[model samples]
Target: MEHRITLNAIAHIRSSFPEKFGIPRQGGLADTRGNIVFEPEYRDVQAFRGLEEYSHIWLVWEFSETLGRQWSPTVRPPRLGGNIRKGVFATRSPFRPNPIGLSCVRLEKVELDTPEGPVLHVLGADLLDGTPILDIKPYLPHVDSHPEAAGGFADRVKEYGLEVDFPRELGAEVTEEERRIICQLLAQDPRPSYQQDPARVYGMRYADLEVKFTVNHETVHVVKIIRSMPD
Candidate 1:
């Protein structure tokens, strides 16, 4: 076996999700948008030549926020109500031997000429803002599509969409676009699967705005929206 291996980030993701707390567990769960800005060294237009032809692309990225942390072989997946432990290999838990993640996002567009060089606009991404990307590969439908694939225990976990109600006064703070994205995130039920306390108010940060909401039965009520103070 090779003694060691190394990887470098070719680009970084700019997304609305400024923090991890409210991000969807997997890509495509929410209609979140993001952009991939290539690093100065990899800014050549040739690097992304013909990339626009593909509708989706696979992103190989580092869990930078969780790097250098110890990992366990068994992990309690939030999908399992955060109670049942399963082998790390059988789950998509971020805490693993290698702090890496793979996600396939819809490529909305690719701009070759920009003040910052080549950029790829994508949709339905679950990545946090400023995530370092190790590599990007076009998704091949013939090879990547598995129509009959079973998701094991994951398939057994039923998905539940929540109703989002943002009062006009509080919702007016954000633009129409931000309001839509906020509703989309809350519809996917951002609260932990194990947490069912209706009285508990959850706060999620997105693009410098703090969204405060509470879950009452199957509905998520937006309580307030506050602009974050400059650091």
Candidate 2:
């Protein structure tokens, strides 16, 4: 059996999430979108002949941020209050032996002949900007889903959502779709589980805007929406 292997990025996803802090913990949690641009070497159109027929796809990507970090056997899961230690293999921790990740996202459209090569417009992807994608596969709902399966310790907080109090004037700064996506993202409560300071504001970058908010009780109040020059 082979003990080691090498893999190259076939495509890279362009997303609004510039960092890992605010992205949803799982795919399909928000309606944010991203475009998958294939590398020149893997840009052949024939490779994706039947890909558009699927409504959703799976992304085999790398935990690019955790590269070079040592893999630990146990990890403090943020979902578990960040104090309880559990085996890393049992959790979806990025700092693992393979440094790989899997995400299931909706395939909005497949642009076959874009200038950037074949581009895939996807939605509800929990991925970072410019994330390297190793592989892609159609999500077969009949074979892949196990709705009745137990979630073990993770089911305890599966219903977590925050009340978002976004001001109307602030919502006018972006398009209707952008406003809706932002609200959905904020409702997921992107703050770390260990943080509980209601007065301390947190800022997250989404697309070209900086969203600033504070959590008061279970409600998240949007304090400001600042637009920054694109880098």
State which candidate has the highest TM-score. Answer: 2
lDDT of 2: 0.92
For model 1, the superposed segments whose C-alpha errors exceed 4 Å read 229-231
Please state every model's RMSD to the true fold in angstroms. Answer: 1.5, 1.3
**Best-fitting candidate, scored by lDDT:** 2
Task: Give, for candidate 2, the lowest lDDT window spanning 10 residues.
Answer: 152-161
Residue-wise C-alpha lDDT for candidate 2, range 8-111, written one tens digit per residue: 99999999999887899999999989999999999999999999899999999999999999999999989888999999988999989999999999999999
Error of 2 at 12 (Å): 0.4
Residue 222 Cα positional deviation in candidate 2, in Å, after optimal superposition: 0.2
Candidate 2 segments exceeding 4 Å error: none
Instruction: For residues 1-231, write the lDDT of model 1, one tens digit per residue.
Output: 766779999999999888898898889887789999999999988888799899999999999988988999999988788899999999988898998999999999999989999999999899989999999999999999999999989889868688999999987799898898889888888777899999999999888899999999999999989987888
List of clashing residue pairs for candidate 1:
none
For all candidates, the clash counts are 0, 0
